[model samples]
Target: MKVKIYPIVRTAAVAVLLSGVSACSKMYDVKPQNVVEAKNTYQNIYDADAAVTGVYGKFLGLAGQYEVLNELRADLMDVTPNAGADLQQINTHNVLPGNAYADPTPFYSVILNCNDVMKNLTIMHNTQKLTDADYNQRWSDIGALRCWLYFQLGLQYGNIPYVTESFSDVNTVKDQSKYPRIALADLVKTLIAFMEALPYKDPYPAANSLITTIDTYPSKMFYVNKNCLLGDLYLWNNDYHKAAIAYKNVMETSTPNGPGDSYNYYNTYTLNSGSDNDAVTQSAWLTFFSRSMQDREYQTEWIWSMVFDKAFAPENPFINLFANSGGKYLVKPSQTAIDNWSAQRQTDGTPYDYRGINTTYKMVNGQPVIMKFLYNYVNASTGIPSDPLAKNGRWYIYRTPTLHLRFAEAANRDGQTKIAWALVNAGIKGAYDDTTIPDPTQRRITNLPFPYDFDARKLDAPTIRGKYHRNLGVRARVNVTNLDVSLQQNANFLAMEDNIINEDALELAYEGNRWQDLMRVALRRNDPSFLADKVYNKLLKDGNPAAATVRAKLMDPKNWFLPFN
Candidate 1:
C-alpha cells in the first residue's frame, strides 16, 4: 500500500480475502430465526385461535345429524321396506347391531375432533406466548367443547370410547380405543366439572351475539355459553333436581321471557326458511343449518350449539338421501308412527298427536301420492316462499331442547302428582282434540261424517278404527259438533309412563336419543314397553307387514346393547 503502484493490488487482495470466508464464521454471524418467524412457519396465536374455532366447528357439524339418530331411536321411522337387499343397512328398532355405518358413526367422528382440539389447546398453552388470561379462557372453551362431545357420545352410544387427549399417530387410535361404557353418573360428573371450569361469559359477545338471541317468533333459544349444556347434562343424568336448577338458571338469565315464559316451538318451514339457508329467522327454536351437515349451527333452543359455517358442514349421507325427494333413497315415517299420531288424543282441545301432520305424499299431477318429507323452498332475502316444492329443505335430525315432557317427568319423579297429572291431562287433551279440521262443525263432519240419520253403508270408515266406535255414536247422538267435546275422553287412559314416553316421542320425534331413553327405562324397570313382549305385541303386531322380519331381527340377544367396533 505504501507504494502507489500497489493500491490496486491491495484492493484485489482484500476482495480475495473476503471470498475465502469460512463456513463456521458465516454460521456464527447469521441471526437465528425468532419465535415470531418460527410461528409464521408453524402455528401462532392466530393459528391457535383458528384451531379453537375448528373445535367449535365440530360441535356445529354434529348438532344437525343428532336429530336423525334421535329420531331413529324413537322408532318414529322404520327402515323403509323397500330399502333394498342391503336390509341390514337400515337402522331402526333393534336392527343397529351390524349397522355401525348408521348415523351414530358420525357422532364418534365428532368426538374425535373434539378430543383433538382439547389436546391441541394444551399444547398451544405451553408452546405459544398467549397471555395467562387468554390461555385460561381458551382452555376453558376447549373443556366446554370436550364436555359437550362426551355428553352427546354418552347419551347416544351409552358406553363410548372416551378420548380426552390428542393422538400423535394412527397407532394411538388403537391405544385410546377403550370402550368402557361410562355410567351416566360418571358422565354427569365429568360434564359438571368441565362446565364449572369453563368461562361462563362469552369472550366475543358482539360478533357471536347472533349465537345469543332469538331472532324471531318461534325462537330457538340457546343457553348463554354453557347454561344449556349444564341443564341438559342434568336432564340426561335424570338429576331432575339439578336439571330444574340449571334450566331455571337459563330461564332467569337468558331470552324472550323469564322463568314462567313459554318456550318457542318451530318446524322445518321456519327452520330452513331462506335462500342462504340462514336459520337466524325468528321461527328457529334451535337449529344446525350450516354447509357442514355435521355442525349444528344457529341453535336457538341449544344452550350452546356447535358452530359450523360455509367453511365446514357435516357429511350427512342419509338426510339428503332419505329426506330429499329427488334422491334415490326414501325413508318415510313408519305406518306405526302414522297410526300413533292419528290415534293419539289430548285431554285439552290442542292436538298432541302429530300423525299425518307435516307429512308429504308423493305428488302425481300435483296431488300428493306418498307421505314423504314436505319439500318447500323460501326466498333467501325475505324468508318467504320461492317455490312450494323445491327440494332445498335443510335437515336437522336431532333436537335436545327441553320439552314439556321434561317438566312432566320432573313432576312425576319428584312426586308432584297434581302437576304431573295436569301436564299429562293437558297433553292427552291436545292430541285428539287438535285436528286439521278448522272448526268444530268441520271436525264433527270429518270424524263422524255419517249423520245420525245418514245410511251406515254410505259412510267412510273412520281413518282410525279402534275402541271409540261407541264414542263416535255418542257424539252423533248428542249432535255434539263441538270439536272440544269430541276429544275430552281420549287421553284419559294414558298412564305416567305413557304420558312421558308419548311426549318424548312426539316432541323429540326423529331425534336420535330415544334408544337411550328406551335402554335407560329398560335398565331401571322391567317395563312392558322395552321388554320382548312389548316389542312383539306392540311394536311388531302379528298382522303388521314386517312383523315376522322384525321378530327375526330382535332374536339376537345382543341386539339390546349396541355393538362397539
Candidate 2:
C-alpha cells in the first residue's frame, strides 16, 4: 500500500516502448551487419562494452596449464608403460597425428576465442561508432592477445596453425586448415615484436577485483603480459641475460617494495588433518590458489595462468590414468629417484629436501609394511583411526620449497658465479645451523616431535647402536652427539656450486624439475652424466637394458627434447 514501484516492471515497460520505437525506424534497419552484429547482435559503445566483457569472460576458462605443463616436463613422474590416456599419450614420446590432435583441448579453445575477438573487432570498427584511437587501441590489444596465444601454441606444439583472422564458417576453417609449424627463433622474434609494441605504461589492471578492482586480467596472468612473455621466451631460448632482465622488469614494476611484502611465494603444506602450514610465510608471488581443482586463478605471484571454470576444467589423462593405487597402471617413480633420496640429507642432519617422501611405515602382524600416499593412522590406545590417505578436496601436487639453493643455480646460470657461490654457501650453512639433534646421538629431530626422518639410512638404522649409521661407512665411529661438528663438515664439503647442484639433484629428486635442470646443465657444460644417471636409467628399467650398459649404446639426440603429440 505505500505506492510501491517495482524497478523490474518499470524497466520492462520502458524497454517495450523503446523496442516499438526502434522497430519503426528505417535508419536502424539500414545499419551495417558485420561480424559484431552477425555474432554478438550488439551495437553502439554500451552494447560493444558488454561484448568486450563477454570476450573477457573467455579468460575465466583459460588458466592453469602453466603449472600442469611445467610439472609434467619436470622429473616428477615418468610416463607409465602402455599409457593410453591423452596426457600419457603426449608425455610418452609419441608424434602428434595432426593439428587437430592436441592433448589438452583448452589450448584450441583459447585460440578459437582469440579469433572470435578479432572478428568481432573488425565488425565493430565497420560501424564507425568507435573513434580511430579507440579502434586502434582495442585492435592492438586483441592482436597482442592473439600473438600470445600463437606464441604458446608454437612453444608447445612447435608446428601450429597461425590463425590471426577469424573465418565466417568455423567448420570450413577447421576442415581446410593446413597448420604449419613455426620456427622457434622466428616465433620468438615475432612474439617479441608484438610484446614490445604493447603499451606497458598504461597497462591493464590487476585480475583480483576484491584486492584491486582497478587490476586487469592480462596484467595478472604472465601469458597475457608483455614483460612476462618476453621473460619466458628468453628463458626458453636459454638467453639468461635477456631473460633475467625481462624477469627483473616484471619483478620491479609489479612490486616495487621487493618480494618480501608483496610476493606471497610460500611453501604451503597440507597435513593429514586438513590443516595447512605455510612455511615461508610470504604471500604467493608466482602462483595462486583457487577453489577449482583444475582451474586456478592467478595468485599475487602469478605472472600468467590459464583460467578454468567448473564447466571447462581440464582432465589430465596421464595423471588420472597412469597413477594407480594398486597395480592398474605402470605410473611410478624410477628406482634412481628412490635410491637418490634413500641416502641423501641436508647439512643440518635433517632428511633430504623431498616433499613427497614415503612417510607411513608401520609394522603389521610383525612385518614391516611400506606405504606411499596413505594418510590414515590408528591410535592403538584410543582406538581412533583417521585415514589421511583419502583424497581430500584440495588439488594435490609436489610443491617445492623456495630455497636459496635454486637462487644460487639461477645466479650461476646468469654468470654471477660469485653471488651464486655465496648463496650456495649461505643455504648450506643455514641448513646445517638450523638442524636439531634429539637424544644427541641416536635420533634425528625436526621442528615437530614426530621423530619423522625421510632419509632411508637414518630411518632404517637401529636406534640401539647409540647413533644412526650411514650406509657408506665413510664416517664410521663418528660421534653423532656432536651434531654441530657433523653438520659443519657436511656444509664444508657441499660448499661448491657443483656439489650444491648434486645435493639439489639428490635432495629434490622425484618431486620433479630434475630432468630439465640436468638438461640446462648439459646445454651449458655438455655434461652427459644427467642422461647417464637420470634419464637413461628409467629406459633401462623398462626393458631397454642396453641403456644401462653405458658402453653398449649411446642415447639419441631426440631424447633431449620431450616428444610432442
Candidate with top lDDT is 1
RMSD of 2: 14.5
Model 1 residue 436 lDDT? 72
TM-score, candidate 2, is 0.53
Report, for every candidate in turn, its global Cα lDDT versus the true structure.
Answer: 0.40, 0.37
Q: Give candidate 1 misplaced runs (Cα > 4 Å).
A: 1-49, 56-68, 81-106, 123-138, 155-157, 168-189, 196-204, 207-225, 256-319, 345-356, 359-403, 420-494, 526-528, 531-558
Q: What is the lDDT of residue 262 in candidate 1?
A: 24
Query: Lowest-scoring 10 consecutive residues by lDDT in candidate 2?
Result: 266-275
lDDT of 2 at 377: 25
Which 10-residue span in candidate 1 carries the lowest summed lDDT? 1-10
Residue 552 displacement in candidate 2 (angstroms): 11
Q: Which candidate leads the pack in TM-score?
A: 1
TM agreement with the true structure for every prediction: 0.58, 0.53
Model 2 lDDT per residue over 386-501, tens place: 43232211122222211233444444465554333432333212232223544433232122211112121133244422111111111111101112233223243323445445
